[model samples]
Target chain A: MAHLASFSFTSSPSNSASSLSPLLQSHQQPHLSSPLQDTLINIDNSATMTNSYKYSVLLPTYNERENLPVIVWLLTKTFQENNINYEIIVIDDNSPDGTLVVAEQLQKIYGEDRILLRPRAGKLGLGTAYVHGIQHATGDFIFIMDADMSHHPKFMPEMIRLQQAKNLDVVTGTRYAGNGGVYGWDLRRKVISRGANFLASVLLRPGVSDLTGSFRLYRKEVLSRLIESCISKGYVFQMEMMVRARQFNFTIGEVPITFVDRVFGDSKMGAMEIVSYAQGLWKLFVAV
Target chain B: MTRATEAATAIGILGTIYLALLFQWLPITLPPTIQEFILPVLPWWVLVTFGAYSLGNIGYHVMTFRDCPEAYDELQVQISQAQNDLRSKGIGL
Candidate 1:
């Protein structure tokens, strides 16, 4: 009878549900746990194991053909050291300088699953590239950073750990925060960056200290929600995302990261970009 | 209308008429002193009317510029079709 009881408890749910025989129910039926109970317990265990989430790193590139290989190496090293399950999704905008070729080589080296190359025709702007990349990302969490090596991969592990520790919806890297600094920036560049951030904060009052920094990790669903709510494009896109995040009451965490100037290729900043940044700020101030 | 509003509207109308006459070959010009002083202290109605007129002119020109290239291509197509039809009907331009 003890053996039968053990067998009944270990059996599947269908078996136990059917085994509630009329004969067993007739005489002062002792509380007999069935195979259904064991099956339910196993299902719960499997569900918990399946819920262990991984991270997807989205690197949007234009023409950083020279910087691609080195940045991928750094990312691989960082994720490997942290023992985190992560995938790097490269969203390239069809760089004429053979950036896709280098990306293909990286994919071969790191297996197709780990390195995903999502390329678009022409330079279709930064905001859309991120949206396109996010559509294909399979991870529960998404990390966005520059592919130009300006945003270091070293800071990513800390951002991930902090997000995990606090259960934060978003973790952004700030250059203006404690122990964080920008290297290879002249006086004019620093002033422009600082002034832009100040102006945006004054107008929008986004709780984040660095509204323009693109290096951050977001819960995949949270990012999808935020991206849909945002309207601005190009450099202003980052600022608007933070503003929308605050409006939606999403929890945000910040980590200090040293932003280095890209060693390869020319800086994409220009006079028109600054003008558009100002215009974007004004639009957000009035619209939001 | 209140006296102030009447006076302001009158000034606006007079100024616009004066500008139209000047553009249409009227041999009249405001004295430097009047131009410097009176124009600076123009009433709100006068200033707003002038601004509206300027904005209307700008909007017209902007629309024209925006549509000119496409409009020209469309006109060319129409003219070519007309010429072909005329030739088919044994006529010439």
Candidate 2:
């Protein structure tokens, strides 16, 4: 945690008639040799205005130590090239592999103001991590992506420009829409992905093309409201957010991008997740 | 008096009648000749068992109609309270 030092100044005019007349005379004169002028000059010189639209990237990690440095480097390079004012908030769930240690090192390399390490005790759910990260974010827009290199930082500039051009409330990357494709998945995996999406669309009728994709950019308040309205956790959480976005009447813009499997570590998808996805779809179908 | 409630009540009554018919058709302690003769014709036990089971089923329907909806509403309230508590503590389900 970074310590913030705040300095406050208070001024009160004296009630003495002589002091009051001098104060009034100083105000009347355009240039006066008074302490008030010195203080005002000091304040004007000391305060510096910062740029607007600081982007906060919320990255939730569990055991992503090896991938942390590389992702941060990519993000830095991309932001520097585009001249985007940004900060990366790493929300680690206290991985046993010392992911926080790496994040701290990155903070030292890039100033603490640019990189923030917000860690929790143990493995909490993904939805909670985003909520926690957003609380500390100072940006007007929040970007969420995986730290496993599955989501590239190169697409960020285009996403921002496209969002500005269209004035969209949310911009999402879709793998199943128009020229976007998935690679490195076997026939069974592809079939399961397509079938699950089809089942959700048939039941919920969410307007988004890819309901299960997680790479998204949202206006900070829009994401907060959508997260509050959503009910599903884990893999189904992403689907629920999109469905709720449609429910609340938010404009959504989709950008086609290829989704590649993670380059490092193991995939988190399992049989239980598939079963839970089906059950969550049924629940949303009835509730929403 | 809704269609769903009436259908549920009808199904409950039919299930009770089926159970009574099965119990009467299969007597536990009957002489072989008497059982054979009675089983072949309309048995006296069938009517009595049907009467008891149908009455029991009708009692269940009346009890459910009186209390089931309120119980369901209470369960929903409990679930909502639990969700709000989790959210306040920064825990997401």
Candidate 3:
């Protein structure tokens, strides 16, 4: 009963159910109940013991020299404070702005074990960057986020907590759900984003909000399988990943996150990107 | 089933029902007033209502979308703190 009291709110209902069963059994066999409750408490302890699980953060970069160090710093700070085991795998696509140079400096500061640099030649796309990053990831779980400061590291612990509580295969950060919002977006940006989200929700019914949000956590095996199944580019890549996860019956959970847009760099939302997004959405609608 | 196929199947079922009613092919009949006045425009009514709902839903979300001024401020402080810490650690940023 005391062990059940310590369970987080997200998992409390289930914990309470298990805790109550022993109490109900106590009414039948008073002597046998103590050992039954002890085993239940031990199960809870073993769940927490699974914190030995390590996270591999795949931060794919292009021209984020100014943002890389700051994002890395925040990630390291968040993980360290939470006593989480994590490694930041920086996959740079040969940004002309010398992002790799800064990543190298960060590795020196954080050590090789913390920061793994996997530099690719030329401006290859994001999907390939993640694939390249995952090939070398050693952790039990994987985190994918933008190098831009828009996807903050602060909400990561909530995502991890939710994943652990629900035993979710994928935990996505949502900017449109409870306590979630965007910082730098104006009315136009808000309108466009909201409209796009509404359309996708109606059409796909993917059961996950914030389809375009890139900040997400996945079991390493689930992510590799998702990557193999996904078939989209640009903004729809993340959306398609959720759609495919549902198609494959992968459990998903959401944590609301504050999106700050880009603090140090220009955010990309051009007509071409929007056109590609529409095309990709339609492709998923028809093909998937 | 893919969403497209699901939607198409639903529409096909509904459309067939409507057509059966419209052509008087069904054993049972819709009321004369409904068959004449309402049935033909039901699809339009649904379309318009759905369009309005979509617009309203998006509008409500846009109006209510949170602006995290505090988060922005906190991020600024963290960024500068990170910069200072990195600088102190001898990593030129």
Candidate 4:
């Protein structure tokens, strides 16, 4: 909202309402009738296009060589079609499957400015990966999501618009809210997810619909601070980030997203993770 | 002032009042019939109600959870498109 004008694609109509997808239009506010409304209003206010906000996507990869290229392509296509300024930071923890090799190939295709490869020596932690990615991030806003293709990049434009409209610190994609849903999850998986979400909601009451969702857009500074303060790892890390975000009184928004469970890789939700999730929830409950 | 302490404080205060009322330690005593029947079973009722609510909530969510077969289908299409595009870009997938 701070004079960061949305991109104006000349090829598309000035009042291109069709740019808003059905999923995005469902949550559309009056001012958001078209994605170009902001540009039209703020065109005269800003002289230079260089100052428009940039979004940096942090995609952490581990044994995702197959999915990496496709996800990056999706992200690139989404941003290009939307005309949104962005960069994708691939934080590969020395993937044994040569995810870094694919990332380098993507860098060559997308150019070094758009795709960044910040590889680590070994498998570290999720929280630290974001921290590392953030250090190299050149964008005003940061997006953290899976490289495993569960979270589609199509929702990112809406997420960005929501953030801009509301001037929110965090905009998380929720599969539990609105028309958001998960694909490929069976009854047992659904039950466990719903049950775990219910328990977390009852106990922590974080005021966010999806506490464990990794698909989120954060103001760069806000993300840096949240990462600095958060102390958990794995699924709980995502949960704690939201809980802590609320504790800091940061404004948050939600965009319904379709999570098509890992199309190429195995999705993990074992008993060990569940137990550790409970322990992490308890820790945040008492400590936060 | 964390969530845990806040919950504990509320429960402790409510529990103290419930105990006092149940034990007839309060200045005003409850009717014997009401005290003997309702008070003792009140906690059980709350527990059962809470458990039922939780189950219902979880069940409702599970049932209503949307299945996006279209998204899966779209992704399948996009994956092929990406591979083709990447291939055209001279990067082997």
Candidate 5:
């Protein structure tokens, strides 16, 4: 488990689970032994593994309580199968639906070292959530993905493999690429996403097929530099990151991914998001 | 080197050779700095390897996909188990 003092919890859990799991209840007791030594050597590499690069999954959650456990389990299974050293930094923005409680349960199951819960006051923007998560991540490669279960962990190994094989600075999951597509989205959403990507490509010339994809693996330093260079605050942040990466001359790779719509809870995207994306794209074209 | 890297390297070398030979005989307005500084530094293989890689990909898929089993079937099972586990706890679908 990572040192408790090492984390910076910006805000406390506003609400707790009304009923605790037996494991959590057991944990509530004074003290207990660790989970059967975990037997897995990769778990030992949670904090900056010595030999190989460790991947830090930055899962920014907001009202993702329902989707959290399934995603975490899927992540655990994926990483375990691939034998990758990793940690999950869940940067939650004070979700009211007991999301933090689910996250805490996840931390217990996976060990505190693997799951870092960094909560904040309220619903901050997506970019700031990433900024907060990066501050606490200890991995050499940082993974940014949604906690809403839209982006499955199945494609992660491919992303990592492509990143390694190509010596890539960035490997983003693209739904528009070969063998990649969106599932469960209506015609309107499909059109919007495609139109947005087309416009961004035409204007920015980033050479990346998908500019709005958030599921990406980044070299920690490259991401830090991009974050510093990027000025987009909200929906435009993902596109801005790609644009800045191109201007700064970073090589980005692509892994085709089937992006599924959220299985539970509502998608936060709406007309406002589209309008802001257009505005942000215009700003990026003019500035960058 | 892996197949992809080998492919990339072979294509890169071929493209470089082709460009050099073509430019030697053909009169093109290409800047000298491109041959000296930029082309050498750029990861042209990323673009150059596309022809071989995508062709291989298309051929392989077209020939094999009809008879090939679903490669990610096991992955689908694992995902179903995970979803069911969540469903048991009434957590997620």
Candidate 6:
């Protein structure tokens, strides 16, 4: 159970809770000014932008002390190797495992500008954690994935490459497509996941294959738009995001990804989350 | 799925029954045994159900046609970053 000083991002607030929180952040974290200005654009074939893009990786962690360091290291290594301009925004919900302390230590090693730690008071909803994290992001694109190692940072470069190649609004990873498959789940768990996804496909017909998949990269504005339109606050949020994105006529593409189960602690998903997902599916069928 | 269709289905089924009774579409000219056996029961239930289903489908389309779609609310944004900051430092609201 470790935590640290609450500092805002370059454009972050001194105290975010103030009812008068600014609508737009006008400042950049002073530390980031130089690097951001001289950012080198990777994937030269990308013709969408005049300048290099800044990536904000939003990592939401709870009791992931053991796996956090490795994930962050991998992410930084991946971005650095590819010469990609990136920032890691960790939104940690006070874990009893001192995950925050490990995050701060990584920040010191990697430098504060590259590793930003934004810690919350308690265990907020997963949806809200992402909400909290995205606000502090100052990047052209946003990446959301698990810190528990279920998702590998190695896939990020390829995801970005594909996104730039297609200029897609969203590029989600699918375990049910291409060469992707679940790595460590038993038969019953596999059946449940497959069944849930199958039901979603039949009901929502969201064009895309993996509706429940969480690993994804989104253009900043598109991600913000979908998040605002989305109503789900739990596991269903992922599915609704894909469904609503289609409803809004946004282009979505998929990349096959091997979804390995978490390597540490425990999985946050459970019976309650599954039940909520079924209810959410029904609501989506009726509404969308 | 709208209220209009629910009401229309009920109305259509009842309406068909009333129209059937008034028009007496069931042929009374048939054999006495046939008339007595099939007259009041079989055609009534099946046609009423079919009538309800058909009108309900039409009503669903009509309601959809007349309904205006609500615009997505664009103003809703993420919460301020201070939610994480203030609490982590132990100065929570």
Candidate 3, A145: how far from true, in Å?
Answer: 0.4
Measured against the true structure, the TM-scores of the candidates, in listed sequence, are 0.62, 0.62, 0.89, 0.88, 0.66, 0.64
Interface RMSD of each: 26.7, 23.0, 0.8, 0.8, 11.4, 18.1
- lDDT by residue (tens digit), candidate 6, A1-288: 011222232233323212111211212233443332222121122322333899999999888776777677678767876678999999999999888987887787778999999999999877788778888999999999978767767667667766765567898987776556665566557656766776677567789878988899999989888988888866688988998899888888787677767655667567887888899888777667
DockQ metric, candidate 5: 0.08
Runs of candidate 4 with Cα error greater than 4 angstroms are: A1-51
True contact recovery of candidate 6? 0.00
lDDT of 1 by residue, A121-224 (tens): 88998778878999999999999988877777767756765565457899999877655667666656766777677667656778887889999999999999
lDDT (CA) per prediction: 0.72, 0.71, 0.85, 0.86, 0.71, 0.68
- What DockQ does each candidate score versus the true complex, computed on alpha carbons? 0.01, 0.01, 0.83, 0.82, 0.08, 0.03
> Candidate 4 chain A — worst ten consecutive residues by lDDT sum?
A42-51
Off by over 4 Å in 2: A1-52, B1-93
> Model 5, range A1-288, lDDT digits (tens) per residue?
333311211122111111112223343453543442221122222311332779999998888887788788989888887688889999888888879988887776678999999999999888778888889999999999988766879788667756764578999987776667665666556656666766676567789887888999999999989998888977689988988888788989888776766667777788888898888887787778
For every candidate in turn, the CA RMSD to the true structure comes to: 25.9, 24.4, 6.7, 6.1, 15.3, 17.7
Q: Residue A153: error of model 5 in Å?
A: 0.8
Candidate 5 residues lying further than 4 Å off, grouped into runs, are A1-51, B1-80, B83-93
Candidate 4 structure quality by residue, lDDT tens digits, A1-288: 423334443233432322334424434455564555544434322322333899999998899999999999999998887678999999999988888988898899899999999999999989999999999999999999998999999998778766765578999999988779999999999999999999999999999989999999999999999999998888999999999999999999898899999888788889998899889889988988
- Candidates ranked by lDDT: 4, 3, 1, 5, 2, 6
Which residue pairs clash in candidate 5? none
Scored against the true structure, residue A14 in model 1 reaches a CA lDDT of 36
**Worst ten-residue run, lDDT, model 6 chain A?**
A17-26
Q: In every candidate, what fraction of the native interface contacts is reproduced?
A: 0.00, 0.00, 0.91, 0.91, 0.08, 0.00
Query: Pick by lDDT: which candidate is best?
Result: 4
Clashing pairs in 2: none
- In the range A1-288, model 3's lDDT, one tens digit per residue, is 544544442256444433432433454564664644555545544444568999999998989999999999999998887688999999998899999999999999899999999999887888888899999999999999998988888777667766776778999999998789989888888988988888888889999879999999999999999888888877999999999999999999888789988887788897787788888888999877
